[model samples]
Target: MKKHNYSAGPSILPQEVLEKAAAAILDFNNSGLSLIEISHRSKDFVAVMEEARSLALELLGLQGKGYQALFLHGGASLEFLMVPYNLMTKAGKAAYLDTGTWASGAIKEAKTFGETVVVASSKAENYTHIPKNYTVPTDADYFHCTSNNTIFGTQMTEFPDLGIPMVCDMSSDIFSRELDFSKFGLIYAGAQKNMGPAGVTLVVLKEDILGKTGRTIPNMLNLQQHIEKESMYNTPPVFATYTSLLTLQWLKNLGGIAEIEKRNNAKAELLYTEIDRNGLFKGTAVVEDRSKMNVTFLLEDESLTEKFDQSWKAADISGLNGHRSVGGYRASIYNAMPIESVQVLVDVMKELERTA
Candidate 1:
């Protein structure tokens, strides 16, 4: 049986990408050295870094001006700190929307550097829905939010368009769906989720937001420093970057982010339909705020959970377990996942229904 991967991060990748990545590990582009062993300072590696950054931005349709994109080292977690460090000033406080684990984590980090106001919190209802109608204070530094709550299976489909600058940690759904690049002053995500393997982080920051902080930021945390170096201030993550480059090439060839978003919508719809239409199952997230990347559901009869696991695993389906916080089952339908894989899981659910 062909096993389908449904794990979240370090998760599914294009089969073709996997094959190419494995082959390159031994001999990169016939350069006669392993991709893992090469110097990140070499011309070949520098070209890899440059192309990856350029193509990633191009894929996002950030072609014109006023915006700069970088693939940095830390995950989005670091971005929570760096964003406030660079964008939030001494007197001004940044506003954040508390949605789930990652959003709260970002809030915690931002507090150490500057005053952070949590404008709204979804934890009131267990993070099943995005908060409705929040206030964005003008005097605040910038508004922050997590685009999608991966663990809770919720998404902010309608972004909070505060008149002030906006920032988001789009880690789980960065390139998975459609977004307006102009609305955000800064954006960051760990590469492990939708983009590539777990090394480089994608950051999109408006050029105007950099120098305003006026406080001394550590060089590594300074977005301007990394941007000025063309993301080569130190040794970059070569293999992960190469994977990201190829992924961008793949996205471009398949059509850009818009086309990919359409597919993502279809995939999420298909899975959610199965969950709703199937007997003995209930969705975890609120209907109004369901996530396209991560779908969490519960079985009507908790006793059958083990059986469901065995049945799916016996069919070679994998990674359906939910996060420890919200337990039941979660199907992480990330970008690389195909419709057919979700169909397999749905079919498995149907078979179980018939058997019961």
Candidate 2:
């Protein structure tokens, strides 16, 4: 049977990119050395580093706009601490919007560094919807938000005009859609989800935003140091960085973010439509705030769970199970997920509806 992957992180990558990465793993650039064994400072790897950074900025329309991209280690989780540690200062507060698990984690980390205020939150209702009509403090150092909630299946469609520096965790939806890159002071994401495999995190920092915090940042956690080194401050994640470069090249060949977004929307609509129209399944997040990347849903009847589960499994669907926190079903349709796979899942749902 054909496999349809819907895993959230460490998820599916483009077939062409995977093939190229695999070949490089064995003999990178025909140098008879694997990408893992090559030295980080080598000229070949240096070129890879430069191209990946340039491609990221170019794809986002941020090139020549004072934005620098860095592919560093330490997942977005660590960034939960680094953002506030380096940006938020004493006698200054940082504002955040709490929408899901990751957003809450970011808030928890920011509190330890400075006076962190949650301007808005949806925790009262189990994070089924995105908070709105909340006021962002202009006097704050920066306003932070998570672009997409993977576990809760909620995403912020329109960002607030905070009138201050804006930071975002775009782990689940970084290159999946187009955004106003200039409005954000910083954007961080774990590359495992949309960009490539696990082991590296992508950080886009506006050079001017640094040095304003007035605190001595650790050498490892400092963004300016990484930017200055061209993402070679340390050895860096060699394999992951190379794979990410391949993926970025694949994206550029496929018309970049604008074209991939159309496909992402079509995939999400196909899955969510079935969940809404079918009697056995219902979507978890609110319609307006539903995530384009992770479409979470639940079975309407507990007794029909086994049958539905078996049906999808038989259709070669993988990672349809939701997060442990929210027990239902989640189909993470990332940038690399093909629409044919989505159509197959939709056909399975229709079959279940008829046979149930």
Candidate 3:
């Protein structure tokens, strides 16, 4: 049976990207050496690193915009601290928007450095919606927000233009849709969601934003040091970075973000339309703030849960269960998820309705 993947992170990737990555793993560039075994300092890997950095900026339309893209380790969790470490001065404060678990984690880390302000939050409402009425203090070092809440299925469709620099964690939704990438002063994302496999995180930031914190930053955590060394500050995640490069190349060949956005919208519409129209189901997130990447919904009749679970499993559908915090089904239709797979889930929903 052909399985339809819907796992949230370490999620689905393009078929072609996976095939290419598999080939490279055994024999990279026909060099008779595995990609993981090759030295990071080797010329072949250096070119890969350079191209990956360049292509990330190019895809976001940030090239020639004083932006430097770095593929680093430790995922977005580490960036929670690295952001404040490199951006927040000893006495300066930072502002954040609490939209989901990851955003809250970032706020917690920033507090250790200095004052961290949460301008607005929907946590009071179980994060079913994004807070719209809030003010970012202009005196803050930077304003941070998560573009998508994978856990709650909420995404920020619009961003506030504060006078201060804006930072964002785009882990779950990066490269899935079109956006004004240049508007953000800094962007970080773990590659597992939409970019590639786990183990590498992409960091794109404006060069001018660094070296001004007036505090000593450790070499490993310093954005300026990583930039100066051209993202080769240490032995990088060779396989992850190369696979990410392959995925980016795939996106570029498919006409980049503009093209992918259309497909994402279509998928979201197909699933959400079913959720709204079906008598047996309804969405969990607010209609206006629903995420295009993660479609979360629930059964109207909880007694039918066993039947519905069996139905989806029989159809070879995987990763449809929601998080523990939200009890329901979550269909994470990311960039690489085919609309055909979504049709399968919708069909399963309709079947449950007809037999109920």
Most accurate candidate by lDDT: 3
| Tens digits of lDDT, candidate 3, 121-195 | 999999999999899998999999999999999999999877888999999999988889888999999999999
How should the candidates be ordered by TM-score, best one leading?
Answer: 3, 2, 1
Q: So what's the TM-score on candidate 2?
A: 0.99
Q: What local lDDT score does residue 43 receive in model 1, on the 0 to 100 scale? A: 82
Ranking by lDDT: 3, 2, 1
Query: Per-residue alpha-carbon lDDT of model 2 for 300-347, expressed as tens digits?
Result: 898988998899999999998999988898899999999999998899
Candidate 2 versus truth, CA RMSD in Å, comes to: 0.9
The alpha-carbon lDDT assigned to residue 193 of candidate 1 equals 81
lDDT-wise, the better of 1 and 2 is 2
Q: List TM-score per model, in order.
A: 0.97, 0.99, 0.99
Model 1 clash tally? Answer: 0
| Candidate 2 colliding pairs | none
RMSD of each: 1.2, 0.9, 0.8
Cα-based lDDT for every prediction: 0.86, 0.92, 0.94
